[model samples]
Structure formats: C-alpha cells, structure tokens
Target chain A: EADIYQTPRYLVIGTGKKITLECSQTMGHDKMYWYQQDPGMELHLIHYSYGVNSTEKGDLSSESTVSRIRTEHFPLTLESARPSHTSQYLCASSDFYEQYFGPGTRLTVT
Target chain B: AQSVAQPEDQVNVAEGNPLTVKCTYSVSGNPYLFWYVQYPNRGLQFLLKYITGDNLVKGSYGFEAEFNKSQTSFHLKKPSALVSDSALYFCAVRDGEVVNFNKFYFGSGTKLNVKP
Candidate 1:
C-alpha cells in the first residue's frame, strides 16, 4: 500500500532532551509538510519541503529544524526539547490538490 | 498565498439526516480544493477534491463536495449522517496555475457529531 509513515507514534521526553521525528513516504511526491496540532485544536504548519535540499519554514515559528537530504525522508529535530513542544506532529505529502497524511506522532515533554 | 476557512468549530446532526460542512477559500488564481477527515488518534483520510470542470465531486465513504467558484466555497455534504461520520473535517486549498506549485493550506477544521 502506498502510504506515508511516521515513527514513534507516542513519545515522552524530558525537557532539554534531544529528539528527532522521522517521516517517510513511498509515493514520489515533491512536497512534504510537517504540522503541529494541539489536542482538539487546529493544525499549524510548522515546516515544509518542496524537494530534496529545499526546506522552508511554515506559518508557525518552530524550535525544530528539518532536513531533506533525500526525497522520501524528511526528519525534524529539536536540539533541545521543551515543554511547549508537547503536541501531535503530523507528516503529509502532496502530489496535487490532495495530500496524504501519516498516523502522526504524539509527544509529551515533561 | 492560498487560504481556507471552515467557519464552524462543530456541527451536530442526527442519524439518517443530511449534513453539511461549510468552507470558503481565497486565492489569486483558480482554486484546487480538497477535504480530509481525521478520526480519533488516527491519520487524516482524503475525503474528496475539486480540481476543475465538475461542480460536484464524489469521494470516499459516500461523501461529496460541491465547488462554487462564484461563491468561493467548497462545502462538504452527505446524504445520510452516521455515527461513524463523527470526526474532524478539514478543508484545504492550493494555488492553481503553472506558476503555482503544490503548496496547500488548510482550514482550522470542524468537528462533526452525528447523534444516533
């Protein structure tokens, strides 16, 4: 099945710990996006990549940084995690008007 | 930049009754709109999309959406509501035309509740 996958479906980390969220898609889409959403809230675009080596920040300011060394892989890393970073992170890939989303990673920072 | 608006935070409907979720968009060029649905603790599933031509687009799970260019809206509608239809719905829009890439913007999302 062609789909997007996100690793570590749920994670709990202490503040200041370093962590990276992984996202990969089997579909050869050029556009990949990362969105942050609180429980029962709207999703905010935090980061996105058009293609390999072409990542850009989205509407929301994020402490996390993303790198797209390969087309299928887009990883978001936080040098130092914080309490405010606790939220659900969603990964998506788009071919045209439609976008496919992953199951999402829910993080809880203590 | 393209933008999407889903005015309601929540919509309640009864089983077997028709339901509608409103959405509006703003873009400089022709609009390519889409609808996605999310269940509790799961990924969002693509419900439908409107690219061009047809005013009404049918999609997964007996769901459909009507695109109105003059009104700048693409509202999701279902003939009969079900308890399973209770989920978060999001409307999205992308910039159209050759110069525009596949950049998508989504609405805040609306929660639909179907009471049995």
Candidate 2:
C-alpha cells in the first residue's frame, strides 16, 4: 500500500480561522501535489512541489500556500478560511508515471 | 496544452456483463496514460497504466485498458462486471515532452454503477 498520510481526515471550523493541512509520504518521491475536489466534481490542482525548497502553483488558482522544507512533507496553510474554501483536499506523491494518493482531508467552513 | 476528457458523467452496466468507460486525451508528445479508481470517501487507487509497448495493458482488480493511438483514446474495460466494481473512475495523461515532461492531467471522472 502507499505510505502517504494526511492529518485531520475531517475538519470543521468557523470562518476567518487559520488552518493547516499536513501531508507526509514515506516514499521519498520528488513530486508532491495538492488538489481540491468538490462533490461530484473533477479534482483541481492547487499546489505542487518538485522537491525540497521547490514549490509552484498548479492549473487552478487557490488562496492557500504550500511549503516543502523536507522531502517527505508538503504542508498547505490557509491564512483565513471561508465557506468557499470548504472542499476535500488530497495529497499525492508521484514516481514518474503513477501517483499514490492519501486518504484526503475534508474541510468544512461555516 | 495537454488535457483529458471523459465524455460520460456516469456509466451503468449489469453484473456479469462486459463494461467500458471511455476516455480521450490531447498531448503535445507521446501519451502516458493511466487509470485510477476511487471508492466513496476514499483516495484514488492505481488501476493500470499504459506507458509504452503493448496497447492492451492489464491492471489490478481484473481491470484493463486498451490504448489506441489512432483514436487517441484509452478506454477502461472489464470482461465481467461485478457490483463491487462500482465507483468513480479517472483517466490521466502525462503532459509535456521529454525535456520538461511533468504534471498529470486528469479527466473529469466517470461514475461507474454496476447493477445486480
């Protein structure tokens, strides 16, 4: 099985609260990605990291920021949460062709 | 730009019958195709991939996909469908050429429903 892990599988918070979603992988992959998925919708790439100290924005624009200080970890932080930000966040690490996904974190903002 | 399209929003099939999910892609260079399945509230699992060589590639869970260069399609198929096979299916393509080849673009996803 893939060793990718995401903390806080489910979260609920009030608007304006800052939150961080943690993602870690034991696969030691160079490529890590963060995607946002809504109910019955296609997953949109939000942020990705090529490797340690390398970060880039994805096809979709997001208000969150990501950091890759360590090769195994890529964490995303939102300065202020809003209802529009409520969605399922997925973390994945790729080894060339195939990508291994985490269980995902479902965030709900009220 | 590289992109993937899964025309069907949903595909329904009867158990014990053959089933297929359609996918088409557009890429600048040769295509690196893949299929992933996701259960409800769960992460996606790698089912199969077509990197090169054989046009017909078999993957986990008795699933397979045939890559057609002429049609630019890679459709997932199963000889006999099972009710447990019902889930969301995604088709992905690796973008960029040999030089800057990075990023995997996924299709909109197709929901598969197998009826007993």
Candidate 3:
C-alpha cells in the first residue's frame, strides 16, 4: 500500500469557513500532486510540487492554495470554502514512473 | 503536451466474463502509460503501468494491460470479471525523456460495471 495519507477522510463544513486538507507521505518522494475529483468524473489537477519550497498550479483552476515547506508534507488550504468547492481531493506521490495515491479527502460544503 | 483518451464512457460485463477498458495516448516522446482504478468515494489506486520492455504488464487485483506502440494504446484487461471489480478506471500518460517534466495527463475515465 502507498504510504501517502490525507487527514479527515471526510469533511463537512459551512460555506466561508477556512479549511486545510493535510497530505503527508512517508515515501520521501520529491514530486507530489493534488487532484480534485467529482463523482464519476475525471480527476482534475489542482496543484503540485517538485520539492520543498516549490509549488505550481495545475491545469484546473482552483481557489485553494498549497505549501511545500517540508518534503513529506504538502498541505492545501482554502481561504474560504464554498459549496462549489465540494468534491473529493486526492494526494499522490511519484516514484519515478508511477504515482501512488492516498485514500482521499471528501469535502462537503454546506 | 501529453494527452490520454478513453473512448468509452462505460463498459458493462457479466461476472466471470472477460473485460477490457480502452485507452489511447499522445505524447512528444516515448510515453509512460499507467492505469488507475478508483473505488466509490476513494482515491485512485495504481493498477498497472507500461514503461518499456514488455507489451503486457500485470498489476494489482488481477488486472493487466497490453501496450500497443503502433496504435498508441494501453488497454486494461482482466480475464474474468467480478462484481467487486466495478469501478472507474483512468488512463494516464507522461513523457519519459523530458527531465523534470511533471505533467501527467489523464483520460476522462471509463466506468466498468461487472454485473453479477
């Protein structure tokens, strides 16, 4: 199993609340990515990091921001959550050719 | 830029029958292909990958994929289907030659339903 993990596997929050989805990996991979997915839909890349102190926005535009202060941790934060932001967020770490994923965080904004 | 295509939106197969989920890709250089399966309310799980050497690569959960260079296809296959195998499958591609190339493009996805 992949060592990557996402906290609060399920999250329910009110609109306008600030939230951070934590993603950590013990694999010590240099490349990490965050993807947003909806039910039965394709995953949309939201953010990624090549290494510590490096981050980039992905193809899909998202309001959330990310930080890569530590090699093992890549956390995504939303300044203000909204119902439109409700979706499943996936974290993955790459080991050369393949990317291993976490269980994912399902966010429900009310 | 790299891109992946999953032509079918859904595939239905009876239990004990064989199954195939089609995928095609485009890339500037040789492609690194991958197959990932997502269960309900869960993140994607790596099923298999094709880097080089073999045209056929086996992966977790009795899943396998055949890589066709001429057609640029890496289709996921299973000899027999099970109801528990029903899930969403995604195909992805990335350029292997590019150094520090981080983009991994994915297909829309194919939903597989194994009816019991």
Candidate 4:
C-alpha cells in the first residue's frame, strides 16, 4: 500500500470558513499533486508541486493555494470556503511513471 | 497538449466473463499510459502502467493493458471478471518529452459493473 495519508477523510464546514486540507507521504517523492473531484466524477487538477518550494497551478483554475515546505507534505488552503468548493480533494505523490494516491478528503460546504 | 478519452461511461460484464475498458490518448510526444481503479468513496488504486517496450503490460489483481501506438489507445483488460472488481476506472496519459513529463491528463473515468 502507498504510504500517503490525508487528514480528516470527511469534512463539513459553513460557508466563508477557511479550511486547510493536509496531505503527507513517507515515500519522499519529489512530485506531489492535489486534485479536486466530484463524487464518482472526473478529476480536475488544482495544484501540484515538483518539489519543496516549487508549487504550480494546474490546468483547472482553483481558488485554493498550496505550499510545499517539506518534501513529504503538500497542504492546500482555501481562504474562504464556498458551497461550490465542496468536493473530494485527493493528494498524490509520483515516482517515475506512476502516482500513488492518498485516501482523499471529502469536503462539504453548507 | 496531452489528453485521454474513455469512450464508454460504463461497462457491464458478468462474472467469469472477459471485460474490456477502452481508452485513447493524444500527446505531443511519446505516450506513457496508466490505469487506475477507484472504489466508491475511496482513493484511486494504481492498477498498471505502460512506459515502453512490449505492447501488453500486466499489472496487479490480474489486470492488463495493451498499448497500441498506431491507434493511440491503451485499453484495460481482464480475462475473467469478478464481482469484487466493480468500480470506477480511469485512464491517464503523460507526455514522455522532458518538458512536460510531470503532467498527466486523465480520462473522465469508466464505471465497471460486474454482475454475479
């Protein structure tokens, strides 16, 4: 199994509340990525990091920001959560050609 | 540009029967293809990947994929289906060129239903 973990498998917060989704891996992978997905739907890349201190936005535009302070940790923060932001957030770390994914965080904004 | 396409939204198969999920891709450079399976409300599990060499690549859980460069297709296959195999499957492609190697384009996903 992949050594990646995502905190708070499920989350529900009120609108306008700030939230941070935590993702970490013990694999020491240099490439980390965050993707937003709806229930049983297509995945949209929101943010990714090539390595520590190297973050980049993905093809899809997102309001969330990410920081890669440590090679193992890549956290995403939404300044103000809206109902539209409610979706599953997945964290992944890649090595060579394959990517291993975390359990994922399902967020709900009410 | 890099992109992946899964023609079927869902594929239905009976237990003990063969199953196939189709995927096609487009990339500016050589293609690196992957197949991932996701259970309901869970993270995606890496099934298999095709980097180079042989056209057919075998992977975990008795799964395999054929990489067809001529058709730009990478289709997932299983000799016999099992009920436990029911889930959502995604096909992803990455460009092999140096500049865009890290980026992966994913298909919309195909739901696999294996009936008993």
Candidate with maximal DockQ: 4
Reference interface contacts recovered per candidate? 0.76, 0.76, 0.88, 0.85
Candidate 1 clash pair list: none
Q: After superposition, how far is residue A35 of candidate 4 from its true place, in Å?
A: 0.3
In candidate 3, stretches whose alpha carbon ends up further than 4 angstroms from where it belongs are B97-100
TM-scores of chain B alone in all candidate structures, in the order given = 0.95, 0.97, 0.95, 0.97
Name the TM-score of candidate 3: 0.97
Clashing residue pairs in candidate 2 are none
Q: Identify the superior model by lDDT, candidate 1 or candidate 4.
A: 4
Ten contiguous residues minimizing lDDT sum, candidate 3 chain A:
A91-100
lDDT of 4: 0.95
Each prediction's DockQ against the real complex: 0.78, 0.83, 0.88, 0.92
The Cα RMSD across the true interface for model 3 is 0.7
Sorted on lDDT, best first, the list reads 4, 2, 3, 1
Rank by DockQ (best first): 4, 3, 2, 1
lDDT of 4 by residue, A34-105 (tens): 999999999999999999999999988999999999999999999999999989999999998799999999
Residue B92 C-alpha lDDT in model 2: 96
Q: Please, what are the lDDT tens digits per residue for candidate 1 over residues A7-85?
A: 9899999999999999999999989999999876788989989899999998899999999999999999999999999
Residue-level error in angstroms, candidate 3, position A27: 0.4
Instruction: Judging by DockQ, tell me the better candidate of 2 and 3.
Output: 3
What is the lDDT, from 0 to 100, of the residue A13 in candidate 4?
98
> Which candidate do you rate higher for TM-score, 1 or 4?
4
What are the RMSDs of all candidates, in order?
1.3, 0.8, 1.1, 0.7
